[model samples]
Target: MKKLALYLGLVILMFLTSCSSSKKMSSVMKTYEVETMGVGNDGTYLIKVTDYFRTSDEMVYLDGLKRDAVHCVIYSGIPAGNGSINQPALMNADTKIEGYEQALNEFFEQKEYLNFINSVVNSSKTITRLKDSKEYRISAVISVNKDELRKYLIDKKIIKSLDFIF
Candidate 1:
C-alpha cells in the first residue's frame, strides 16, 4: 500500500511540473468589417466598397481620399437585367465602374493592411442606379493596416514590407 501511494504521488508531481513548464506560443490576429452602397441600373446594381480607418476621433484621412484606402482592382462582378446579377464579361462603361469598386475593396481588405498594421478594419460598398437610365454607380470604403501605415511613414527612408503573420 505504501509503495502504491508513493508512485501515485510521484505521478501527480510530474504532471504538475510539466503543466507549469509548458510555454504558450505567441500569435497575431486581425478583424475586419464592411459597409456597402448600391446603385440600380436597368434592373442591375452597382456596388462600391470602402474601408473604415479609425473612429471619427482619430485621423480623418489616411494616405489619400479620406481615412480609408482604395483598391486598384475589381473584386467581383454581377450581371444586370430582370433584377438579377451575374459576374458577366467586362463590357461597356458600367463594367469599368464596377471594376474600380472591386479593386478598392480588395486593396483595403488585404491581410498586409490589417494584420501587419494591427488595426481593426471595416469597409462598405454601395450601388445606385439611375431611375430611367442604363447607368449604375458603385462605391466602397476600406480601412486597414493603420499601424503599418504609420510605420511606413516613419521609415520613409526605406520601403517597409507589409504582410499578415498568420
Candidate 2:
C-alpha cells in the first residue's frame, strides 16, 4: 500500500538523521583541549578548556566550554600543568563511548553537566576570531566537582567504582 511505503520511508529517513547527529556529537566531543590549572577544594578541579565554535553567542559559547570541560574530565583527562599533577580520565582511553552513547547523549542534552560545574571565571574568559574564518576560539577556567561527577558516573554504571580491581 502507498501509505505503508510512505511510512517506511519516513522511518528510514529519521533513523539516518539520528545516526548522523550522534556521530557528529561524538566527533565534536573529541575536539577540545584541557589544561590543569590547579586543584580546587573538596575534590574539585580547576582547569582551562579551549574549543572552537562557529558562533560567538555568549550562551552557546559558555555551554560549549562547560560541555568540553566535562567531556575532558570524563574521556581525555587533564594534562599536568600550573602546579597540578596529571589526572587520568574517569573512563579509560581505550574504552569506546559507543556503548554509553545514549546515557551520555541524554546527560548532555538534558544539561546535567551543569550540576558538576562549581563556577566559571568569566574574568578569565578570552575570545578570538580565527584568521579568515567565522569560527571563534574561546577559553576559560572552570571549577568542576570531579568527585561528584565520578560518583554519578559510577551510579549510572557508565564507569566502575573506585574500588574495582582488574
- The superposed Cα distance between candidate 2 and the true structure at residue 8, in angstroms, equals 41
lDDT at residue 127 of model 2 (Cα atoms): 95
lDDT of 1: 0.35
Every candidate's lDDT: 0.35, 0.86
Candidate 2 lDDT tens digits, 12-93 = 9999999888643463436788888887897898999899999989899999899989988888788898888899888884
Predicted structure 1, TM vs. truth: 0.22
Worst 10 residues of 2 by lDDT: 22-31
* Candidate 1, superposed: residue stretches over 4 Å from native: 1-123, 130-135, 158-166
Q: Write the per-residue lDDT of candidate 1 for residues 67-128, one digit (tens) a residue.
A: 22212111223324334435332223432322343433343555333333222234443445
Q: What local lDDT does model 1 show for residue 137?
A: 39
- Measured over all alpha carbons after superposition, the RMSD of each candidate to the real structure, in angstroms, is 17.0, 8.6
Residue 5 in model 2: lDDT: 100
Error of 2 at 119 (Å): 0.4
